[model samples]
Target: MNYTLTPLGDRAIVIELGNEITIATHNLVQSVVAFLDQHPFDWITEYIPAFTTVTIFYNPLLVLPKTNQTTSASPYEHVVNELIPYLDNLEENHSELGRTIEIPVCYGGELGPDLPYVAEYHNLSEEQIVDLHSKGDYLVYMIGFAPGFPYIGGMPEDLATPRKDNPRLKIPAGSVGIAGNQTGVYPIETPGGWQLIGRTPLPLFDPELEPPTLLKTGDVIRFKPITKQEFDSYKEDKA
Candidate 1:
């Protein structure tokens, strides 16, 4: 339940739960988000959860007249005071377990142009790279950058690689890539710097769907390698 409250702009307060990007910090962030979702303040606008921080944005107009010291106390101070009590007992509120999702990926060739680069970078064969990547137990740390894009963690250190010096202009949706110690799938075609290693046939983003994002924060992800033929068949089935 250890945290610090800092003001963001005029109407938002950032609650920093921890300093690291470990599972412990992720849990704390989730706990705080869950608490706010269940017991939302009327003056609050929205809350954004990150690796180790949960930013709470508020409506100052709604909070102005409600503060005890309306003449002196700012909305930020009032909101901080109100939030401290709830956060002090936050450790008691545990978030529910995340859902495990299996994603089938087709590695190398046209879909994954950078697979060879990654293999060379690690001084391993392409098959070895695929084996290590597919066997990893990943977690969706957050949904960000682009709509439905999942910033996944838990990539093995052996597969670690730096991003491209010159980013690609338009990476296709479902293109899986590695950047630093993390791995992720591009939910939509966009410019990126991550080294592409594979691609999934799954449609990760659909604006018309109830929940547009295929993955959510705290979800578990398992990469399953698929053959080129199998990847084509999967896409055809979905189409």
Candidate 2:
């Protein structure tokens, strides 16, 4: 995917990281970061990644205009030209950024009222559904919408289901769910529309923890089905 750098005034260029936020694109983001750091452009500040793009924040007041640079040569143009060559030649790197966390979840019961419905909709037994979800390796694409909310990829196509027509008032935290092509865990109890197949008792977002987010971008997540008894025990320990 190609990048388009837009000048946000004299200070910063927003690098648009197009629609490739998979493991393949992880290297692209890191390469950009490494290059930017080495170049030492005072104007560039932060590089934020979303599902499809990376927004580069910059500080213009600090970076003076080049002595020989003309008004026609914008910082965005200069940065993009310098960056593309590096990105083009660099191989896509897939570094192990985070651990594969196996989260234990309990399916069905009050915690997952829609579990049966989802299975029925897909014409599969509840056990089959659980096995499919548990077996897949999910990649954490981006963290957004809520704190520690991971937008996971790698869900089985057969298990793909639409979200609830109407969102619930209070979705308990540690909810494991799917919406369209993506699957994720709700870090905190809040309103949501994702199809709830199970609930993990793990605290996904712990403010008291050194890193509040239980997972981050580039981490791999897999759900392990456990009995309600196990779920209860884990929740109690967290408390």
Candidate 3:
């Protein structure tokens, strides 16, 4: 599907791809990301890719006017026009699949406070809940809400569950949860409403890390179930 570009405030431009959230739209978004990064304008500051759109941030003052054309009224329009040619000629990105990162989660009990509730909601056993979550291969569609938080896709329909009626005041970092047709984890101590299934031991956000955020758009994530004993062991090892 073709995309339309619109000015987002004064410093950003939002490209609207197809409204549907499918693999095709996501790939197209990534292709846009790849092209922008490869052929970057001097004023371009950053590119934020969501499920089906990429919002580009830039500096208006630094944006060099097109050499061959007359000055335009809106810098955003000029930027959009310059971008159109690159997108129009973009080929489908045939890059290899992203590396699958396995996250070990301690399922049930306190770590997964909503596990029993979720199982009952679907007439499923807690073991079945664990199996369904661990077996699914999730794709990182975007990182939003909280820092390092990943909005993932690819959960099987049968295991889909709704969010908590009342969200907790604070969900701890690494709390794995499902809401409606989507599933994700809380990267930091943040308020959220997704059904809690487990908790990962990793600190998804770290101030000392080179790129602070652990996951990125287009990454693949898979959960691995671990016993409480294993969870403690892993934590101690990291410590």
Give the best candidate by lDDT.
1
- lDDT at residue 183 of model 2 (Cα atoms): 82
Ranking by TM-score: 3, 1, 2
Clash total of candidate 1? 0
Ranking by lDDT: 1, 3, 2
- Write model 3 residue lDDT over 184-220, tens digit each, in one string: 8888888878899899998898989989988988899
lDDT string, candidate 1, 206-235, tens digits:
999988778888899999999999999999
Each model's lDDT? 0.89, 0.76, 0.86
Tens digits of per-residue lDDT, candidate 2, 1-239, equal 35666776665566666566666666456455556557665566766566655566665443436675455665556666655786576554536456799989899888778899889999999999999999978887778899999888889999889999999888888888888877888998889898998899888887888789888766788899999999988878868
- The lDDT, on a scale of 0 to 1, for candidate 2 is 0.76
Candidate RMSDs in Å, in order, are 1.9, 3.5, 2.0
The list of candidate 3 runs beyond 4 A from truth reads 66-72
User: What TM-score does structure 1 among the candidates reach?
Assistant: 0.93
Model 1 weakest 10-residue run by lDDT: 62-71
